[model samples]
Target: MKTPNHFKLTALAAIFSCFVLTACNGANSSTASSTADVILTIPVEAVLTRHGEISSSYRTTATLEARGEAEVISKATGIVQHILVEEGDAVSAGQLLAQLDNERQQYSLNKEKAELNRLASELTRTKEMHERKLISSDVFEKLQWQFDAMQASVNLAELALKETEVRAPISGVISRRYAKLGQLVNQYATQSLFHIVSNQQLEAVVHLPEQQLAQARIGQNALLEFAGMLPVNAELVRISPVVDAASGTVRAVLRVANEQQLLKPGMFAQVQLQFDVKADALLLPKRALMTTDNSPTVFVVNAENKVSRKPVSLGYQSDNTVEILSGLALGDKVVIAGQSALKDDALVNVVSVKQFE
Candidate 1:
């Protein structure tokens, strides 16, 4: 059983080598087990599907215009004697705006009245004589005809005197005044005495693309945005039946109520014509949608922290949100971030949750 020193040393060395090898193998097995226990997961931001309101709209720009505008003109030729109203004055229909010199008209009226009275007295006398058979029938008839002619002349004279006063034809604000004191104005003059604009109701004129013709219906609600001011509500009152041949657009008119007189004509405004709206709908953040495969797609996270890729049918899409028609359910979590790196059945860790405002 005794061995040499050299052989003993060599055997001992071999045993030490085997022990080292066994230790290394055990360490390697422990590391492999730890690695197998670990599961890889992707971090992402998610939001829950919720019910909200959304609308589909067409956007355009237009200028505000007065719904009613008119140029005030004189109906009779005369010298402007009095300027009753100034620019920016509110006037009613048939309100006197100015007065003209009517001395000549008054004198003419007086002369006609005197002649009319004389003729009336003669006609009365003629009638009495005829009734008594003192005057011939032909003479009485002639006197009656003269009296009727005189009466018509007197009426004309009165109308001429009334025309000396200039009046407003419409109810509106006087935008301009052209007539001054002692200025001679006539009906045939091309210049208007005043410019009036009705501002109680305003109009917003916009041209929409021809493709939106079917959706552009009368009585649709529209929103008008102005710079440094609150948005105004308007209604679609008119839409041109024919599309413009040159621009391939349709002219649409939206009426805005300016009862407060806050808006004026020729102001630029941004217009949003809403054609469709969904009051209660399943809404999702538009950022969660992935459109790589033609149809809209979203990565939905299930209860097991696993994401399932889904194709969704979309409805009305508005700012920052879209209406989900199918392929998603309420309370389902959808990945808004890190969705690009995800696949079906991939494990995910929701880093943050966002709620739609």
Candidate 2:
């Protein structure tokens, strides 16, 4: 039987279509395989266990304030003549805070000064007269004694004059005021002239329970975090060596240096006392860690470009890293990213190994 030309043409077209489809499908498969075989650059870090110290910190609340503060008060009885400083004013040592009525005191001082001058001149003249035997020894001695009494009076008067001017015993800002203009202040007065606190240098006081008290000592390192303030570097300045029987807590004072005036008195503070130190322990970034069924695991990359799940023995954890006690060694490559999709013996490509600087 002879084949038709149109039939042969149609059959040829179908075969060509089949060949084209097969070639297209093969190309698609190749492209899919290439996409699946992804070469990823991952950041890695070497596991290093060095003989250094790691501290375990205990958190406690505290109050920030100057090491010392006090209220300025009049030491003598007087009527206020002038108010030298106001609230929020900064005063220095011996800086006049207020002035008292000194008219009477000034008059007394002047009288004492005149008597001292006259007595001193008489004493000089009497000594000269005695030396030359121009006067009796009793007369000269009496003149000398009178001169001593005048000198003592002058000294007392000068002290009274100084007391008229209220001065600051320390340098600080006046946070409050009680005495006003023309106010009568008495000696050993209980009223406060000005409340001054030294904020330039501050300290934080924390109360620690007896259980954690032993971990604290003088000069131990500490960290202070104040509410709405940055973390500050501090150290244990004083520890009540004995725990308070009433509260069952020990008092710890940490000195906080605030050259920038960042810390304020009565501000809430959180203190961390670091005690335990671990040496020769492997540590990893906290983000590089993952947990499985309560088992802490890390994705470690082997030399063959394969990732395997590893169980790590962790010791102490810090703000940024976790201390690993075992299951890791120095120079071991650990993956920090893409850990969620990692599996045992899964193919991987190390992007980078983060080096410690």
Candidate 3:
């Protein structure tokens, strides 16, 4: 239908405006609906359970030690002439450790020997005269006593001279050297020649609490550890009967054979005291448990195919596994990996157990 020009233009403009408004409203509503329908997809992994034995060992670090150790000191007063052995050298009982300048001691011994010879000759003549009735028995007895005294003096002098040559008292290895060549030494002076440590056997001394004393006994099997050697078998040799009043702990000694002589004495040692054993317990790898706020927890698969964190009570842990004291049931799948991105009710996909490994 043909109408006036101005009226037709106005009608066309109104129609275009209405169409633009309707299009704008429809676009806004579509955008809002799309935003509400948005869903996030996250990747996840599954959990599993396995059966294994968990060691109930109380883990502690210890040190190596020698069975018997001593400090070699000089007994006589003299100047050090020579030092034969050095540190880290093997020594045996009665082995020459060091030598002292024994010039004076040798002269004393020689003088005593000469004096004894003269006395012996005098006593012989006196004895002959007395037997022939030319001398009284009292005179012959006095000569005999003087000769015996001189003989004893000579023997003592020889012993003193021999002591100048220092000797080892026990079979061990020389661990230190203090006496040097030309150093003055005396009975009261500090003349530490060497430090000998018996390395054929090693002993571990540990202070255990009073409560653990009853559990410790003689001949009990123990494991010994050192710095560079593997764990070696040992036996409980002794335990102090009385507890230390100040420390309230008893000392325990474990004897270990040192076939390789790897252990040294005076080394601080730690000991693991196995007080009891658990016949059966649910154990899991220590890696499986995660801590949040000091409360130990583990992830388990829920029915909705999601991971849920469950708090667990723990007992003794050893090697790598920890005992599940409570809050876990048998056959429950535990998440060993993919824990970093996990959240409550998060979706999960079962990957191979190798992922945890």
Candidate 4:
């Protein structure tokens, strides 16, 4: 049938537009299929579980103190004339800590010296007289005795003079100063002149319950943890031979060598003692275990990359690992990371494997 050229042209243009639209729709469908065919995977990190040694640690609070300490005291009855050191001053054995006024001691020493000189001269004269028969033997012997007594007196006075200087009895840091300048100090006084403590090595003094005595022993390894400080190495040095009847506790002493002099006395620290290490124990990182339904559970991946929520029985827990008593076998792969985003039977792609070091 004859039709208008403008109408024919319009119909042709409409058909071409429809063909282009159909082609575009087909391409979109193919692209969507390609995307769907690609297997969606969740990247994750995993570890191959194995059996390792694990131990349970018991913690007790303690204080780090000097291994050796002494109370310095005055040796002579006199007033404190001078103090050579203050608190926190490091001192050595026999180092002068304070000095008493030496006026009286010096006078006594001088008097003894003059008497000894006179007696010595008298003895010399008496010996010459006795040898020449100018004096009796008895007189000469008396002069010799007098000279000996005077000499001994001089020795005593010299010793007393030395006692005027109060010296440290031990090498340590001065922790407390009890003597003040011009303070009357007695030789027989019970008051301590200075409190000195050794800082070269420290002790972790702990009083543990009697029950813990079974685990604590000499030479056992221990760790000392201080605030804002790294754990220090320590060992059990002493255990009290007897337990306190009132507290039912036994005293334990752990020694920590402060070779670098990093720790000071009276610092609070926690003592961690590990015991009963279970070798060949089925262990896993603590992060792998999660509380599921109020029970310890873990996500274990299978060969097909499918996860299974495993309810595990735990025995002991160490620093960052736990002992798996049941519900897992050796050579199983565990999801240590990305475990929170998984469900039972969920597919996963292990992006990386973590090695135990």
Compared with the true structure, what per-residue lDDT tens digits does model 2 show for residues 238-303? Answer: 888788999999888888887787677888877788777676556677777899999999988888
Number of clashing pairs, model 1? 0
Predicted model with the maximum lDDT: 1
TM-score of each: 0.85, 0.68, 0.67, 0.70
Which scores greater on lDDT, model 2 or model 3? 2
The full ranking of all candidates by TM-score, starting with the best, is 1, 4, 2, 3
* Rank by lDDT (best first): 1, 4, 2, 3
lDDT assessment of candidate 1? 0.91
lDDT tens digits by residue: candidate 4, 192-307: 89999999998888887888788776887888888999999898888899999999998888889997878998899888876567889988888888898899898988989989
Question: What overall lDDT, based on C-alpha atoms, would model 4 receive against the true structure?
Answer: 0.87
By summed lDDT, the worst window of 10 consecutive residues in model 1 runs over 33-42
Model 1: runs farther than 4 Å from truth? 1-41
Per-residue lDDT of 198 in model 4: 93
Off by over 4 Å in 4: 1-47, 50-53, 122-149, 188-191, 276-282, 287-299, 305-316, 324-330, 335-357
Query: Candidate 4, clashing residue pairs?
Result: none
Greater-lDDT candidate between 1 and 2 = 1
